[model samples]
Target: MATSDLHMQLIAYDYVNDRKTDGGSLAKMASLIRQAREEAAETGALCILLDNGDTFQGTPVSDFLAKHPGTHPHPMVDALNALRYDAVGLGNHDLDYGLDYLGRCLAQFQAPVLCANLKTSALPMIMPHTIFQREVQTASGETISLRLGVVSAMPQLTASWNRHQLAGNADVEPAMPSLVRAVQEVRNQGADVVVALAHMGIATIDEGEDAQNEIVAIAGIPGIDAVVGGHTHLRFPGPDHNGVQGVDSETGLIGRVPTVMPGNSGSDLGVIDLRLHRPENALHPQVVSCTVQLRSVDGETPEDTEIAAVSEMAHDKTRAYLARPVAQLSNPMHSYFALARPSHVPALLAAAKRKAISEAIAGTELERLPLLAAVATPATGGFDGPENFVSLPAGELKRRHVAGLLPYANQVWAVKATGARLSGWLERSALLFNVLRPGDGDQMLVDPQVPGFRYDAIYGLTYEIDPTRAPRFDAAGKAISNEVGRVSDIRWQGKLVDPDQEFLVAVTNHRAGGGGVFRPFDDAEIVVKKAAPLDQALIDYLKNPDCHDIRTAAPWRFTPKLGVSAILHTAPEALEHLGDIPSLHPEPYGTTPEGFARLRLHL
Candidate 1:
């Protein structure tokens, strides 16, 4: 065949088939593959499709695979093999289901699985690199030989998991060295092109610096042509730092070296078109030009029909798994972000944190004092759907719903803080607040209208925040407000709290570790007490409550409207209720009430 007729198209993507439902995006992805294959066939070019990891975990299918080992089939593995993938890299999520399951998936895949980082006591089937040399005859009756070498590497953080099930031997620093050696071996075997199909994140930053020192350090070594990276979910355009576009078969920009990362979850496809040049004087071929293109998955084109079919099957399987009954609720409790501050979910979460912390400090010397304040961060937001309110109908609540609510599976922790320290914590939580500048048109980080992140903690002691006052702490954690936002009206158990006396504070592990935009609490001179899981506490608390109705109690009041003050108090009438048995009133608070918690304003 003529040199111009000989062409190879390399496509890479992270197919997250295990998590998404078959009928949704997964089906769309399958359709995309079919279309690509048809287009490639017409061009008389060989299309080499590759996956850069994250295939195993995320959705109900993964959960089913974990629970019922031999019963549920591996959806991702089957889908990849059906598409006839050229190669796949080992991802961190692949180890989530354990090494045995990963091994099973690898065995089932028809294509070669490449990984230089992962190690196992069991071997022979698992190889570091795979070299493919094929001679294809064109329609004009001319044959051309093409050689390709592919090697892969997983990230170093995979070692944090249980070693017994997944062996992530902590010698990942030697991956680049081994990869260079593998490239030499492939070259010796007459491979024309050497490709490092790495499951590593791209290192380049916009400031013209290689942020990932490891990848940059590896690119400095010789023989590796192109590095297809993953993990960080970043998108790179052309020849990055270290050299020219390495993988370019046409015009070798950046000294004939190219690096690419296609991002994650079938979001986009990384297409690399390379052209090779053969000089009359030299026997070895050189990469001339390399061009990279990003095709978005969310495009207008119709998806692959075959892949879509498989996705539908997987969706059916997932729906069947999620349909199983777990627990019954007596009352319908809605997880409404809008009503959290004025309703009971936040209070319930705070109560759970308080209970968990109280139990943790039961035998400790600090357990005697009354548990004063509890704060809980809403880990799951309604960004995808209804952030304000997620209502559960009166029926059996499946395990999926519970998992959806508390997705992180975080533990609760309690620490003792003085009244001043408690005030500091609240200030940190208020970091979600962004001061409205004049003529700003309401475009701020924290929306001034959204009440979710704005909700304050259910304090055991009464205190007030002057929104008009400036922040007390500067960026360096030093006191800067002078006397602004002072914590006045502070009372615990109807008595003024002493600023010198220490009080126990309840919070979740996420917030304690400086999550929820809170500052790092590691410097606090307080004892750290580990507590029970927050989700379990929520489940238990729900069962133990005499009334499932979420009611607002006294001392918890908010100024809903300006100039017109309203009191939030539990009413005799019950509102919107759901569940098997109506155990509690749905409407807990009254719009207007007399003699509720007093908040005297000085005008």
Candidate 2:
């Protein structure tokens, strides 16, 4: 059994929203773990529970702990130790809080923390591979000892993504070669079966050795038996990945290996069952067949008392800090119609980031150039469902509201970019919308495959997104040849932008560090790196009255197309704020069975 991308949700409660969410939390997933173990025991099988990384960060509880490092014994570690995980792998997000904090977490976890790709002489809490010997009874009533060799690797961009925390702390190696060597070492050590805990998503195309998401390629390695994959928050053996060329989506098989990528945030548990047999002439057990499936967690599932108990103290502490007021909201903010047009969520972020970049590059040659800010909404409705939209009422805003705005700990970065690069950046972002015809009706506005966080809009520029034109980039951010771009009529400071002119754009380090594999930063140099993350900057931005100019800014709009209409899905509560986006000409189109409110917008 495997769980990936838990994101430090040790409790079945949301401190940010102050409600008990059903499908997330370690306490909730702990129930599924127990049931899986019981089911395996009934068949006289040895069940080992493992977790892929992204385990140490995400929730308000983890944020509270990050502010005060030694306040508690690492809430995630307490829950993992209580559940008795066999082995844990590292994800890129697991190292966000800094190396010292990760070292403390590594010491607190009772299980072996495995990372074959990351190398560091400073911290010795990681191992390339580990072996677990367990005794299980076969169908023939024979008891035998099995050696389970576990190897783990994450994306090579780990250091880059968390650039401030990891440059001197560790060196993140490439996943493909690292895992291949680690698997060979495990085989040379006489392990019976090898399992790969890959902290990566499956790539549809065969990207070479250095690509970030390469589980499909990793599964083709020589000695691997079963693979657990993550980092894209996608599920395998399900409809989310239906028609990829090299994968058997229904069976979760890449080539002959059964690969499982459990959905993020404790949504599903990945179970890969292997039936093994030993021939009369063989000295060790051999796998006869393999199958993979996902078990989902719902509201009715019971929470494990032990795991719940392990998380309560820290939960209380986080809730106390969550109530502390950060600022007074001059206006309300909601992501309901962020995709339909510009919303206050991104606008507010742009204001904060732009001000920070201006101060950071003051008096420098970079400051003399045109200044702009590019930001994406984190709370757009995607795999997180309709409730994913940010909804902050006007009043005394608290830290919880800030958390709702931008949850990740992304630091600010100022990069030098040219007009050509900026245009490519906007075009890449325009890939979020599908091509719409002049007379097509009720078409989906955004692609389900494209995440909202990748759809960035530059705050200081005005452009038209031509959904009718082909995109210069694909879904994976790779360039497509001979295609007219989706973004056109690019203007900055009320003037047409020259392709050769320079500009300083403010963005989070995640983008500068290859979060979406953006090409603008391929050879770009960041002039400023903020020590304090944008979360802190946002708090300061909200308290000041000078930053209120972003309240009514609209960055980008669709190219005019008569008699065309499209459907945009948002939260049901979005109807209350329909007045905010008068330009979209939104009309109520009822609700989806999945609870998203559909708004028909004329293109």
Candidate 3:
């Protein structure tokens, strides 16, 4: 059995909404683990629990714990220990806090912690792989000792993403070479079954030279027996995947290898049943058959009492920390229709970033130039679900609300870029929408393939997007066309910006570090690199009355096409905020089967 991208959801609480979410948390999925283990025991099968990384470092609770250092046993470590995890693989986010902090937390793990690709002296305790030798009875009542060799590796971008934490102490090698060596090393150690715990998604998610998801490649390796994948926050062996060359999307088989990628935040429990048989003349057991299952978790699912009890104190403390007042809100804040129209949610974030960067570069030469901030709504009714939105009432704002607005633990960074780069950045983000034909009616507005977080809206400049034209950049931030593409009439300060004009842009380290697509910032010079994460910046910004009366209206719009209409899928609560975007001229169509409310926008 396996879990991936748990993202610090040891409990069932949603700090953003300040309520208990229905379909998340390791506590809820703990029941499924117990059930699977019981079934395996009843059938005389070996049930080993493994995690596919990104086990921590998300949510308000995670931030609270990371900030407040303590000598107490890490709640996640305790929970995983109590749950009896056989082995745990490393994900990119696991190193987000720092190598030192991560190493400290990892030291308490009762099971083997694995990360095959990373070469970090700071985290010397992390092993490349581990061999678990256990005895399982065959159907004929013959006792057989099996060596289950589990080799793990994550994306090479782990070091690139967390450079601040591991600049001098560590470096991550490319996945193929690192994993191949680790797999061979384990194979040489006399292993019966080789399971690749890959902390990555399938190749179809991202294509070309810098493809991040290497699940397909890992499955193609000769020594790998069964594979477990994650980091896409998606499910496998289901319709969520499209068939690739060696991947069987319908059956979750990657090159005849049974694979499973359970959904993130404990939404699903991935189970792979391997029927192994050893011949009398053979030295090792062979996997004769394999079955992969992704069990869904819902509110009705029973949570493990022990798991919840173990993390109760931390859960209660997280609630109190998020409840502390930051400031008062003039009105409710939400990002339900951030894609369909300009909204205040992202505008508020942009304003805070601008303030932080402005102060950080006070006397520096970069501060003398025009400053801008690029930010996007993290919750835009995408893979995180429709309910994954920021919804705060018109009252005192709290830390929890800020967490909903900016969920990631990213520090703000300042970059110096020319107008050309800025324009290219916006053009790259414009690809989030599908080109709408003039004569078409009820066409889909946003491209579901593009991540909403990558749809950044620059606050220092105003521009209009013409999606009727082909996007200059592809979803991978690669240039597919030479045309200016989509973004047009960009004005920095009531005037059109020259291509060579320079500006100071405030952005997250993840963006500056090229976490996602739109990597034009490579040539941009770094001006300021602050150690503070975004949540802390926003909290400080809100506490100050100077930044409180900031602009709420966004400065961008879609190029209107007569006789053309598009369907926008957003949260159902968007119905109440129709007045928030009178420009969209939206009409309620209905709700999608996926639970997102559909709105018909007449362009």
Worst 10 residues of 2 by lDDT: 516-525
lDDT for each residue of candidate 3 in 1-603, tens digit (9 for 90 to 100): 999999999878877777876878899889999888899899889889999999778878788888887988888999999999999999999988887789888999989999889897787778999999998898889887889899999888766677767778889888888889988998899888899999989865456666679998899898898899999888898877875567777778887899999999989999888898778898777788888889999879988899998888888898999888998876677788888777677777777788888888778777688988888777888887788777777879888888888777889888888899988888888889999887677789998878798788898788898878889977677787566598899998789999999898888888887777657345337668873578777877776634343444466888765457888888898899888777678899988888998998877
Model 3 lDDT, residue 375, Cα: 88
Per-model CA lDDT versus the true structure: 0.51, 0.85, 0.84
| Candidate 1 off by > 4 Å | 1-24, 120-127, 136-142, 161-191, 200-224, 232-260, 280-284, 298-314, 325-396, 406-439, 446-542, 545-603
Let me know the TM-score candidate 3 reaches against the reference structure.
Answer: 0.96
Question: Candidate 2 — what's its lDDT?
Answer: 0.85
Number of clashing residue pairs, candidate 2: 0
**Poorest lDDT segment (10 consecutive residues) of candidate 3:** 545-554
Question: Model 2 TM-score?
Answer: 0.97
Each model's number of backbone clashes?
Answer: 31, 0, 0
Off by over 4 Å in 2: 205-210, 520-524
What TM-score, computed on C-alpha atoms, does each candidate reach? 0.60, 0.97, 0.96
Error of 3 at 17 (Å): 2.0
